[model samples]
Target: MKKILIVEDEKDLAENLRDLLEALGYVVVKVFDQAQFVLEYLKTEAVDLILMDVMIKGSMDGIKLTEEIKKSHPIPVVFITAFSDQGVLERISKGKYEGYLLKPFSLQALKSAVFLALNKHAILEKDLEGASKNSLKIRDKGYVVPVSQDDILFVEADGLYSKIVTIQKTYVLRGILKEISKNLDPKKFVRVHKSFTININQVTSLNAKELVIGEHIIPIRRGFYKSLLGLIKLN
Candidate 1:
């Protein structure tokens, strides 16, 4: 079963989230205060995902807690917030959160977010476990690209197509971001910018403003900066 850690301070909200997740067949673990305790549990056990509240009673806010947790553990996190102001959205997006759950969310919305978050994590784990090395057959082209996962440097959107760039060559395919995202390893490739996806291994370094993949510089979108940092550092 996929285990989840719930980090919300509100008693009623926490219980409601726990019940909802449990009903959906996910094993839920609730942590109401002191996110630092979560840091320890993460070290000892593996958690599939986290549902964190932006405003908590604890000493650390959700963003700060995420920063600390990501330093050593890179589990996927979805922010739960009551405020949906543009400023808050921009801030949350900077964290590269898997998804967001606004307060008073419907059951369907919460479940959908959970499913997406888990799926993303699963894809990412596959990449880390060597999904990249597997040969991918291009549909109907009879063209089998001789590429290893390690050779992949980055994947970006070129107009309406998705371009897979490796150390040796680039492959342009007909697809949308969602379609391509399903095939690539999530752990290895992340959509940091709206138009670009990058291989985590190819990242030589990350500046506050841009991602450096060899000589190529990719600008980090304001919303994906935090999540990108987590992936870069954790991986």
Candidate 2:
């Protein structure tokens, strides 16, 4: 069974979420309104996912707490926020959360978000575990080619398809950029734009706007520059 942690301030809502998740076969742990308690619990236990409320009781809000937790634990977090203000949305976008649910969400919506978040996290974890020997399998004209992950410099979205660029060649795969990115190792690849995911190990230079992998210059989307910077060391 997958373990899930709920960080909501409302006792009633938290209980409801716990009941719903538990009924769906997940082991749920509820932490009502305490950011410190959540952090402390994480130190002694492991969970597959976290359902975080935006305005929990603490000096650090959900977005800030999520950022802090991600610095040490890469556990996927799905924000459950009632606020839809521009400020809140912008802040949430800047954070490293997997998904979000707005106020008064339906049961089905909650189910779908949690399921997708957990599923995406599972794919990422699987890819990370296989990072040492995993190769992206691509179908060519008649044969399937195995492209080693380390050899990939970047992946670019081409409408419905994605172009996987390696050191020597590029292959087109029939999948959208978002779907393809979830299967890549997050530690090795970062989505710098809506249309580009690049290998950090292969980056030669980077600035506020773009990054270079060998001879190719990949544009960094507005909000993604910070994400890319977080993966690298600075002087």
Candidate 3:
């Protein structure tokens, strides 16, 4: 069973969330309001996802706590906040979180968010396991072939299929861009456009609009620029 941690302040709400998640077959751990306790618990136990409230009884708020957690753990976090203001959202966006739910959200919405977060995290863990093998498994002509992740330059969406471009050759995969990208290492690859996901290690140069991987110039969509920048260091 998947484990989940709920860092909520309100006792009643925390109990409700725990009961709901437990009923759904998840192992739920609740930290009433202490950020420190949550951090300490994580050192000993592993959880698949975290449900954090923006405002909690601790020295650091949920946003800051999440930031600290990301530095040490790659665990996915879903923010539960009452605030939906632009400033609060922008601040939340600066952190590495998987999802967020505004106040007054329905139980169904909460369930969906939890399910999606867990599913996405599962994909990331699977990809990380593949990365440890130093190659990606691709289906080709009824056979599974291994491709070096380092050799991959970029991926592009082509109608119903996604093309994986490598230094040697390109492989046409039988999935959409989003589906294909879920298998790549998040630290090594990033989606720069709706139609493109590039290997950051292969990037040669970048401008405000596009990035270069050898001779291939990939367009950087408006919202994705920040994500690409976060993965690379700028001198």
Candidate 4:
């Protein structure tokens, strides 16, 4: 079930909405009268969707609160406000809202809005999941070793075999450099030299022709030097 957050100043209306949402089979994680409360809550918990009333307590209205929430958490939002004020509607139009429900809306109308918002959110979450497949299983000996792309520090092409180095240990598997690198994320792992491939995250420091990871000093080949430096953004 999709988790929803209700931000409404009206106590009775908030409870009614919560009950209605629960009846519809969606999980109402919590309700807040103030936008500030929601901000604090979001710090610890993850919400799938937000049902925000346009008008609320505190200086930050629902729209502005949504903007703040979006800076870090880009979740789907549905506006459930009583007033269709021109200014509020304009702001809502510019905001990342999936649906808008006018006050005095029927339970069916509420259901439609929430259902659509969560459906859109579900698709987005699915896409995100597909993009974050940053892990690989290494066929080491009879057993298999699972490793995260981010955890891998470097790989050295050792003739017929490749040496995989992680934060903790190193494994020499029977594979060529090109074959072994196909399992890693291309964006995070790059060939710095003919024999060395380093993870972008593992670079501790770099100079004109070399990068250091842990105690290993990987040389930057003349052919790959410029491209290697361009890929890494050092502070």
After the best TM-score superposition of candidate 4, give how far the Cα of residue 208 lies from its true spot, in angstroms: 26
- Candidate 1: C-alpha lDDT: 0.80
Q: Which pairs clash (backbone N, Cα, C closer than 3 Å) in model 4? A: none
What's the TM-score of each model vs. the native? 0.55, 0.57, 0.57, 0.59
Give the runs in model 2 whose Cα sits over 4 Å from its true position: 133-235
Reference-based lDDT, residue 54, model 3: 96
Clashing pairs in 3: none
Residues 103-128, model 4: lDDT tens digits: 99999999999888888878988886
Per-candidate Cα RMSD to the true structure, in Å, reads: 18.9, 18.0, 17.1, 12.9
lDDT score, residue 81, model 1?
92
Q: What is the lDDT of residue 82 in candidate 4?
A: 83
The better candidate by TM-score, 2 or 4, is: 4
Q: Mind giving the per-residue lDDT tens digits that candidate 3 earns over 1-235? A: 8888999998888888898889888888656587899888888988888999999996899999999999899999999999989999999998789899988788899889998988898898899776657777888888878898889999999989999999988899989999988888887888888899999999877877999998999999876666677676543
User: Model 4: which ten-residue window has the lowest total lDDT?
Assistant: 128-137
lDDT of 1 by residue, 180-219 (tens): 7677767777878877878888888886678889778998
**Model 2, 151: alpha-carbon shift in Å?**
8.1
